[model samples]
Target: MKHSITMLEKTALAICIFIALIAAAQPELMTEHIQPVVQDILSFLGSGFFLFVNFLLFAVIILSFSPLGGRKIGGEHAKIEYSNFGWFAMLFAAGMGSGLVFWGVAEPALHFMNPPLKQSLYPDRLASSLALTLVNWGAHAWALYAVFGLVLGGLTQYSGNSGDICAPVMSAFGNKLSLRKKRGVVFTIKLIAVFAVFFGVVGTIANSTLLISKGVEIELGITSPLLIGTVIVSVLFVTYTLSAKLGLRRGVQSLSIFNVLLAFSLLIWLLFIVPVAPIMKIALDGTGYYLQLLATGTWQFDSQLNTSTWATHWTYNYYFWWLAWGPFVGVFLANISQGRKVWQFILAVVGIPTCVTIIWFSVFSGAAIEWDKLNQAGILSAIKHDYTQGLFVFFSQLGWQGTILIWSSLLLLLVFVATSADSAILVIRQLVQNQFKNESTLYVWCLALFMCSFALLLQQDEPLNRSIAILGALPFLAVFILQLAGFLKEFVRDLCA
Candidate 1:
């Protein structure tokens, strides 16, 4: 146990390096051969994959209003550590900020043009764009998170133990195990959990750097976008490292609050500046349409308005991506969520973020869809030609080319990335730390994470990164399901008593 974190790092690092080496040596084989294998695996997971996550969300909804929802995650008398606002800021930034920015402008446009579905249900290009986009970003994603965070927080508060993923499982099933057996179980869970978080963050950092590169080119007109991107990520790594060093309350919380405000400022501007009628109309209609088709499992197979290919690429991939991100996001949520009731945590974790995405997609995607309709600035062509630069291009088209708008956006992205990586660093250290006593483990893992992400950015093998990221979630997903089951069992017993 003393050197468990070191051992975990060695194990995870070896696997990551081994995979990277194989992908590096034969990039084509990896892309051509390995990627299809991954796609096949995802296809095998299929509707079951979609259903499992959706069911988790549904389960959370049922529980949130029951007696379970009134139960406090921490002690009944514990004081809240972070304000609801700050807590939400961290959760949103860490959980889905980068995804929102990347997909916000691009997805609606793509769906508008290609209309991923073969059926005519949502075939109206401009009208249903927000609906198509929101389904992915909305309640389903947050539902997974709320459960994980609640369980983690529950174990921590109930037992006066700072719990890891294995805690709930142990609480449920390890009661008969000897001390040695429990340690073994925890050691094993940490090994997989650490790697899953690593892959997810590295993939996100790599993809986010692409967005930063485009932002630099669009905002500052710098020539070497790649180099600029590297610098930007490096700076973010340094910033988050220091933030991690400050611990949760001071470092991560401050950054989260700032980024949420920054991102919201942009959302407000776009929503207000853009015509009110279309944005409101698209959001209202799209929401109803999305809710109506909630059970269709449109992500599973070929449908009238969509193709199986579209589901495989978007919905299936996102399911894994969100799951992969669970540990990083869950740990952060658990840490900051003390003193909150289960229902409040659910509301904070599931409801607020979902609503934010609805508004965000409504404003951003709605505006882009309107522009595509008007062809006022050829918005569709801009996004089609270069999706990474979509947000910048949208800004340019809207005549918000002022440095204040552009530079502030660049800052907003940076801070969001920083808060995410920083919060994950804090959690990863706790996961891999030596019985939760190791300090140097935090710095070592933090730097190692950014370096891995930096190395992947250099490789620029997005498909491989994305494929492995998707795969990383599979093991973790199995573990989380067990944890959820374990949590429910223990809670029921408590309720009965």
Candidate 2:
């Protein structure tokens, strides 16, 4: 059994490397072909049916937390405090930090400039442009996370299984078949988890490296910004991985807390120095539009005359991107979420941070948009040039105080990247150990980090994201299907009983 397990691990690793190679070899073709498939799957799954199911699940959770239903679920008997604030902090760092920090200003401005589908809703480039920004960032994107967390957490805790998040999908196979009876099932689960994490880590490392490289290139005339940035990120990832290998209590948790504090400081700075009234107005209008368009915007996939392109670019791309990050983020979330109830996990992981993200994006991105409108500046043009450069340009427009914002933004970006790296490393450790709380888990995490950084360097223009999208899309669909099946099965069983 031990030898077989070793062989299985080796095979999984080989498959990951092979996929990485293929992605590196044919990025454009791979992206063009694979992205459409991901879009179709996400479109199908993210349609009205999926939305209705998610709403039902949310209602169930709300009811489950009430006094009457809480008693039924043994919520009253539960002894833990649930650490609501800690949960929020961790969830914020895990879910939105990397992407928000990178895209908060850039995304809104991009939408404002291009207007994904060139929809006639915002014929005049007024504050309404901010509405579309909030729509993409706020509602459906976070809704998916909420749904995934609720189902995964509920299944793990309620079913009294091993409490591994990935177990639910695996359990969908049932204990009947001979294949399920063998060790192959365990190997397959581990393999899936491994691939998922690899996909997320590589994409993140590459994107973050790209951002940092661009930042350096703008600040200093570094001709080989990509190479330099890759090396720097590789080094930092190695260091963080070593820290992760040192164990969560000592390394991962500490770093996460620090990252949160840094992010908080940045927010505080923005609020105090930046004008707030415009941001508040933008946020309010954006939130209203988001609510109005939530239902209609989700399924607006028009293939003819380029109507679907916006859905393809904003909604579908966002959906697949989130799905790509799901496995690593899900596994990492599952690990930290012990001793907490499913309801608590769902709310903490998905709800609070989402609200916070809405506010954060509004403040940062909205302020930039407002600044541009007031000054009639070319901030939108900078965003058009490069999404990563937009944030710096927005900061620069803030005057002398802008320097402080730039430095703070840079630091915040680093912290966010580090937090993500730490989590990815931890997830990698968990997969390799095949058990939570292993003493040598940190070592395995560091090794995985090294491998991720290596891939980032070797395959700079690799369609690593395409591979991630494909691999993540499969298990994501599987998990969604299993959750639906489980919900239906439980509903029927309750009806009969």
Candidate 3:
């Protein structure tokens, strides 16, 4: 099979590399100057972000029950390519990534120590902290992916377009432009997609590896961030690159299944040991708080509670992070979800993984809270010092079993990181090459991604790394709105037909 390249692909690749170059050379510029501007922009757009995501969640639910929901993605006769288990596993692994593991213990503890709500009872604060964590990781985040995936799948399978990021953009307005102008638009959007994905994944890599390096030190007593980061990045690059080479079925699918099982095994073990009553209580109450606040309070940044910037720092940052990942995950989901009905796609994408998230966070955070109540270990203090240490600190309270659990978590975290990087490499190839063809360039691209991530690790400042990630994702806000419009236009056309 011959793989042909175009100027569009070249331009996109060039722009991606240039962004990485900027990050590597002028980290201060991004952190010092660009960070404040980006934060303010995100603040201004906060309400819009909340409202859009809320719309997506409700829209997906309504669409799942409406007449359009009955439509099959690749037509009525197309058969499913992946088993239900495989489908769920891959989508969950690809979308959630290591952030779930990285934040499982830390986020809840952080929120508990400094919760958004100022005036609340002790138990209410606990439940509300977990609820806020859920708000970040739960339905709203997945709904963005759910709706975007539906649109991408409809276009790729039903509208006869290639799996390029620009397909939806082109479909939305391509008819109004000339051939030369259309090519320019396609080139521009693909460039933005590549930039968004590269920076977003780089941030993930920096953060996950920071955690993994600390995990290595905990297990093996290797204290050098440089050595640990180098080894982890090298291993991650090789592993994911090999997986990409093996393609989706043999590589990604198998890894995703194993990841989900491993993660759940950890969750189940925690469930058995943690105070079951508290776990259940937090899960129930947290979920209630999440739903109750879904519309009214999820996006609020209260001034009286000294949380005026809390929403800006955490919630808005997360929204942009999800938006940045939307195109990559959307493309990956649409590709795998070829034969499912609209409602099936919506439910599976938005429902199953979200339930898993709520449960995962509840069990882990509930356990941390229970232990903290006893002062078994300074879990909150550890998290306050370095968010990566929360998982290990919480594990330390488990006695002899702590060793085994921490090691198991280390393995799971590594695989989670690998799966994320692997899928990202595959997606970048598809976007740049305009197809899913495997070639030498895939390896080169993987190495480039590693370079970008490695530069972030070299910075060695968590807050700075996070700011860069947010900055990188900022441009995609406009792109997401464009894609949303394109999707609705296409959906309405299909309804009319």
**Which of the numbered candidates is closest to the native, going by highest lDDT?**
3
Clashing pairs in 2: 245-442
Better of 1 and 2 by lDDT: 1
Q: Give the Cα RMSD of candidate 1.
A: 2.8
**What Cα-based lDDT does every candidate model obtain?**
0.74, 0.59, 0.80
Candidate topping TM-score: 3
TM-score preference between candidates 1 and 3, better one? 3
Residue-by-residue lDDT tens digits, candidate 1, 414-462? 7877887888777777786565566666676676766666666766655
Each candidate structure's TM-score, on Cα atoms with residue i matched to residue i, is 0.91, 0.82, 0.94
lDDT by residue for model 2 (207-279), tens? 6666666666766668896577766676666657666666566666666677788777778788887789988
Question: Which candidate order results from sorting by lDDT in descending order?
Answer: 3, 1, 2
Order by TM-score, highest first: 3, 1, 2
Candidate 1, backbone clash total: 8
Kindly provide the TM-score of model 3 when superposed on the true structure, using C-alpha atoms. Answer: 0.94
lDDT of 3 by residue, 360-445 (tens): 88888888988888775788888888888889988878887888889888889888878888888888778777444648777778
List runs of model 1 lying over 4 Å from the truth: 1-6, 13-34, 155-162, 175-180, 295-305, 400-403
